[model samples]
Target: MNTGRDEDALRWDGDDDPTLDVGTRTAGADPTPDASGHDAASGEDAPPLALPDGFTAVGKDSDTVGHIEADGTVVMPGDKAPLSSPMLITLGILAGVYLLFTIGWIVGGLRLQGTAQFLVSPVGYQVALWLAVAAPALWFVTAYALTRSSKSWVRIVWLLAGLVVLVPWPFIMVGAVGTVAR
Candidate 1:
């Protein structure tokens, strides 16, 4: 649709091609130059990130690397890759542990009103069960958080271990309060 009046080829307003600032609007056609003798507006092309193949560009055409599955599906995952079974398993374990502990507390409290089906110390039994589940879940969470951190694994391990050691103190204190009140 260009009239093709001038000598220099028209440049796109944007690198995306659709919003072109062609012809006289280009930096090449800028009348004023900076101290370096080149137009300051010429550095616009440096923002784009390079990408690999199989990821075909669609509308708006950003320079970001889009993910392309082997089945030819395009997914823009950004900084993260898809989770594997191990990762999903780890997440599931964490969720299960937290849920078990929370539900156990509620159920134990409800059963405290003279239920023959519940244990002598229903809350203790529930706590023990939840602790059993928490061990592996904590291991996975600590290892994951530590491994992903920039700090040394030793430091991360120590920090998480300290937190683990400290976590049960409040529960122990509550138990002591009950014993002392009796």
Candidate 2:
């Protein structure tokens, strides 16, 4: 019975190329010597890798790759930190609120369909209803995009403002059941 595990099937073209042997070195081992005859970890006064123009090295062992300006200032590019846990949670909550607002608008607008038809044409009512339904999402996206370059607090403030301004008033008053809440 053949196990159907052919070794030849797992091999790709250029599999024997030495240049493709990345991450194959053991821990604490020096990297292969470059064409300049210098080992990367040999502690010699030579850079490990040549960086392209306008590009700077970052991450582990990046201090050795720091670029020096003519004025003797060392320029090191740092990685942008990810969003904090609290900010992420806050954004998630805001997104949930916006989603709920959109659902509320949809339900509320549909509930008003009968009354709206009497005041406006069927097409006009439908267009208005859809616009209302999309208002929350549009506001959220716009605020997020516009405030991307601003501080986190500014974004939060804009989102909070939208929450206040885009309240589904029709839904709050008439509700999904279509009964006026005193």
Candidate 3:
């Protein structure tokens, strides 16, 4: 008899597939369709399978596990890790570094005001200065999100580069001595 399920249903990508039911075969019924005495055209009834003790049946509530879609993309389990604790710690530290850079801009911008006149008006300069200060954090977040499917090292490299390249120049120049006289 054609059960309507195709042969592809037998292929399991991973554990937790709903189709992977654990049960014994019914008596007088073969797993495969064949021309034996118990043929589909015979219309004979097969006995109910006796389940083992403590064996719970798989129900509709069961989660859909990993599977390869028609497009050939391997979809991972829903419970898979998005990011570990150590990776979170690294990201937290990077966030803190970005915060420190913002503080540096506030302090150094005040000091730099006395040393020179900005090419743009003071108001325009302030807007550009703050955007520059915020750029590193934005870069880190964007790179981390974009590289979710990529290797960890790729994300790490991009963040490290942002940390170095986005250093506040005004903060570094003023140093411990404060802003210099013209």
Q: Indicate the worst ten consecutive residues by lDDT in candidate 1.
A: 43-52
- Model 3, 1-182: lDDT tens per residue? 98746955875557567677555566775554232224343355433222334434366523333444454454434534457678889878887887777777766766676554545677777777778767766887788899887777788788888788878777778854455677
- Model 1 vs. true fold: TM: 0.29
Best-fitting candidate, measured by TM-score? 2
95, model 2: CA deviation in Å? 0.5
Ranking by TM-score: 2, 3, 1
Q: Alpha-carbon error at 92 in model 2, in Å?
A: 0.6
TM-score for predicted model 2 compared with the true structure: 0.56
lDDT of 2 at 132: 86
* Alpha-carbon local distance difference test for all models: 0.48, 0.77, 0.65
Instruction: Single out the weakest 10-residue window by summed lDDT for candidate 2.
Output: 73-82
Clashes of each: 2, 0, 0
Runs off by more than 4 Å, candidate 1 = 1-62, 77-80, 107-182
| Model 2 lDDT per residue over 1-182, tens place | 87756876988879999998653445786775544547666534444443445776778655545455455545443423346799999999999999999999988888878988998999999998889889889988999899877789999999999999999987887886558466
The C-alpha TM-scores of every prediction are 0.29, 0.56, 0.52
User: Residue 162 of model 2: what lDDT?
Assistant: 95
